[model samples]
Target chain A: MKNTAIEVLAVKNLKKSFILHNQNSIELPVFDNISFSLKEGECLVLAGPSGTGKSTLLRSIYGNYLTHFGEINIYHNQSWINLVEATPHSILNVRRQTLGYVSQFLRVIPRISTLDLVAEPLLEQGETEVHSINRAKDILQKLAIPETLWDLPPATFSGGEQQRVNIAITFVKEFPILLLDEPTASLDQKNKQAVIDLIINARDKGTAIIGIFHDEYVRNAVGTSIFDIEEAKHAA
Target chain B: MTMSLQNPLLKVENLSHYYGDQIGCENINFDIYNGEVLGVVGESGSGKTTLLKLISGLLCPNAGSVAFDTRIEGLRDIYKMSEPERRLLMRTDWGIVYQNPKDGLRMNVSAGANIGERLMAIGNRNYANIRSDSSDWLEKVEMDLERMDHFPETFSGGMLQRLQIARNLITKPRLVFMDEPTSGLDVSVQARLLDLVRGLVSKLGIACVIVSHDLGVMRLLSHRLMVMKSGKVVEQGLTDQVLDDPQDPYTQLLVSSILPV
Candidate 1:
């Protein structure tokens, strides 16, 4: 049967260029006229050799790259809004429910407990403090974080522990579109499998997933389709 | 395939059950092999729960047979077996993980005692050995061994879920039946617990029949998929094939309805 997938994200005529300072501030073209669409419940993996602006393309789609010249159209609240031209307030609203971005490094709050950090999104969604803390505790337990460390800050935790805390926070709430950047970079093999399972679960929930994965095992396990940045740049 | 050559662990044929005049399920037929994970998916009231209870011998089926091959006895109809024999099978060779933690766990008992109860049921009586093994299982499911003395009521939901899993698997049952194992938690919590279940289920090579309305859980855990509608199976096939290219209209609707992340 033909797939009746709805288009959740569409990018048209996308172009990105960076100013090179060492070479007399040259306007080096990173990519041009890159366009693609992501359907609900579909995973699109960005594949190519390094320096192909794969990560840049993902950030551009997330509206983090402000200087990009293109339309990053995201379907939200019964309409399509261009992230490139969207106001900051609209972008925040869109991100609050529609878009979730997981980068390589976590931006940790200095004094917040790990449980509170993970529960922040649910609190923002108006869940009661008790409910939010209980839910956060559950996620932390699943990630193998001990209960003793939950009330402590994540700043002093190990790399894997911090990454798990970061993952716990990002996935605590379900979003319509998820952007993952090397989500399992610092995880051990066992925990890496945990992350892979989480990604697959997200995709199966009809989340439109666009991610950059360096691990071949993870790429093969969860990816349904691949979007080669080199091909996007060179496609006629 | 080679699976057809070997005897199946459980063969269910034309199983029919009713709740008064209403149909619980009708003419259900399937085979569960050793080391296989079979997922049953449907809307609530589609009789998925009824079918599970029937085959597990908790509810008597109105008609048909459930043939379970036991380690001691050759293939025997589950319904025909004596109560003691069936109870023995359930305690030793089979495990059931309920959707609610309270249903599967002893709330007033300590976490270690809950797991140790299963071990003791199967004839492990050394208190020291039981305590050590319970601690090991606690670590395996990633719960703290320190919580071994705590009551299930004092544990968090996810911890209780993990504790329930450790309790169920402590005896190392050859087959397990899970009903909506992750349904009661948040998205991230469900993902983590599902991950743990997937890893443990595979690492131990246990045959399983899991029932869930959540298609994501089935797709990730089941090797085979059976989609039910209105007390009948609409489709059955390999997990990927049935989920990715559902042939039945009901299956199609179900697959298409999953709201992507």
Candidate 2:
């Protein structure tokens, strides 16, 4: 058992519900009164069937989706900030250095080259052009991106290529906490292996990881603890 | 863990070099067999990088010889070969993976061209065949084949590193020199890249000389270990033995300093 004293993230009484206007104005409760704690170097895998709001729970912690009620507290530096009540500026600051999210899509400015897109975070962090570009190039190479398309917009890239580029940008920084949503869905065997290795490395470095992995192999390889949303629903 | 000892693919004997009066490395000796991985680890200012440069032909050693076993020439001193001969050897029989992909890749050309250039250098001319081979290598390094035409200037760091690996390994080089191949990325990215490297090295059965300050990397990939301090070897043995039970105090500190996960 992990000590809650050193917990990086703690959720208490987390609840979410939405009005189903199309279905007689009924209110659909996703999950209620859920509490858990995640420590450093621990991964909590949200395992359940589709439509279980697995992604919703992850986004709520990231402050993208607002919950009906509950406390999503994330420990930053020393004190804990309640995501459900924190201001936008605090959320932004926490996201910059402490939290990272790798969704299933690659969102970038149109016409921007792949290199600039991936180098944006480092460049924003005040890294020099030479150093940032060099670092960006290093990550791209590890993800198996060919050089010729680096200057072109990723809009024209295949699904797997774009996903790899997305992963590259998110992983380029070393955030203390990460949320992964099917990070390797479009990857092949070799690429999947690469992603798995990256996840393991991050965990070993004491990053708290929370993710939803539909691939059983990947889930087994990366998950240290399971957070079954379906079971949570039943328990509630 | 053990590689074929039959014909030591590369032999470095009494190798010594200097940058002005300062020592680079002195009297370094080792033999890398076919499909062997030799790890060199030390703190900053150690001669590990310099020794790698010397062995990979980037820097000429002031003394001793680097002999390689070639199919046609048998065991011949690499320094004695003509410039063209040495260049050919580099293209066909040897590969070097730089710590920074920027140092090893051509940023102007398309990723496919970067990989295909090596094949063209070695007399391959069919455009279709070259393109096909480049695509295959891209896949091998986990890159999408569709981006073969993209220039390296726009690639992310991890993507560029993978492309560089694919570019260097496409020619099926028998021996590879890697300089901190997994440094400067987040731990997760580094781990993935290291796994890719380990898989490729073993699949291709290529001998390698890897240099890194991270003892974890050395333990994960190296078959034999060489510890250096003050430009001299202090302890050398199997990777596990040297890491688990160090004879030198420097090595002991290094092993103990690994942050617990």
Candidate 3:
């Protein structure tokens, strides 16, 4: 286990629901009163069956979804910001600096080469183009993405290949907090092991991580603690 | 990260425009930092163009102010400035590329003259320097130096657009407003143009507000996106986040409507 003295992320009394406005304003409650906190060098794996709102919980913490009530406080740049109340500009700033998210799919601008896509985050951090491209090449090679495909866009890449590209983009830079959704779902055993190693390395570097992994082996390999949403709901 | 720490280059607050009772755009607000790109996307008549015009000072807004950090004055409402001051700012510090290349270019002027006009406006009188800078920009936009004296009317749609880009960027403007820059071009041409625009924007560290209905363009160039519906901003966020997991219903529809090739 690593040191848990410095808190990186905290969620308190979080609640969210989907309103079907077109369908007579029907309400679909996803989760309620869910709360968790993560410390530096900790990986909290969200454990639950399908439809238990594991992904929803992660999206809420990332500020992609608006919660009905609660606070998602993040410690960034030696300050605390409630993501629930932060402006979009501040959220983007926080995302650029402290938060790194790897969703299930790779979303990018069309016609952008894979190499440039992966190197973008570093460029945003003020790295020179040459250095950023070199670092991207190293990470892409480590993820087993063939050199031939690095020049092409990920739009035509296979499902597993695209997932690896998504993973590579996030891992190219070290972020203080990471939220990953099914990163290794489409990856093979070799690629899965590589991702696991990357996660462990990030954790050892004092990065707090929250991930939802369906694979039992992956969960066991990286998780410092498991937060079961179903159990939390029952207890609530 | 360094971008957010700096003061905003342009700040727009509660901007709204009305054509009599009809709305152009309502209650718009955004701040653009140096080297940042903000994309506005919406279907036809979503006021994307109107919003651009409002901020560029081409059209006056009924409400709100457009604050710019000028070189002389710190930050002032552009709409309130004297007409000459505003025109000088437009000529010196800003560039606007219209949807139709013809709208922004001079029909009778040679390509070199078009690019050199802005430099001359800012008081560059040496003929050799002007000629060399114009040729350099033409090459930067990937046009042949041989075509420096060719008229824009003789050029193809893609070439015309590239010339427009070269002309706008010659002044090294701090902010650029692009309205549907890649539309009406072949796919390959569009791709090349997008790549060129992306390269130049980052290389020059020029802030841009680009209005396009093409999600691919938004995904390619913008750091942040604001989705418009009718005349209101329905949603806005980081480009990848907004597109990957769109929260608004309209944005979801718009995103799903794209037919995969």
CA lDDT, every prediction?
0.83, 0.84, 0.90
* B1-261 per-residue lDDT for model 1 (tens digits): 112226778999999998888989999988887767899999999999999998887998999999999987778999899999899888888898898989999998899999899889878889999999999999999897789899999888888888988998988887899988888888777867876776676567688899999987787777788989889988876665567546567786788789985
Q: Which pairs of residues have clashing backbones in candidate 1?
A: A205-B259, A205-B260, A206-B260, A206-B261, A207-B260, A207-B261
TM-score on alpha carbons, each prediction = 0.54, 0.53, 0.92
Output the TM-score of candidate 3. 0.92
Could you tell which candidate, 1 or 3, scores higher by DockQ?
3
Residue A55 miss distance in model 2 (angstroms): 47
Each candidate's DockQ: 0.02, 0.01, 0.34
What shift in Å separates residue A40 of candidate 2 from its native position after superposition? 47
Q: Which ten residues in a row have the lowest lDDT in candidate 2 chain B?
A: B1-10
- Compose the digit string of candidate 3's lDDT tens values, residues B137-167: 9999999999999999899999999999999
Which candidate model has the greater DockQ, 2 or 3?
A: 3
After superposition, the stretches of candidate 3 with alpha carbons farther than 4 Å from their true spots are B234-261
Error of 1 at B86 (Å): 0.4
What class would a CAPRI assessor give candidate 2's docking? incorrect
Q: What DockQ does model 1 achieve? A: 0.02
Which segments of model 1 are wrong by more than 4 Å?
A1-236, B1-5
Ranking by lDDT: 3, 2, 1
Location of the lowest summed lDDT over 10 successive residues in candidate 3 chain B: B1-10
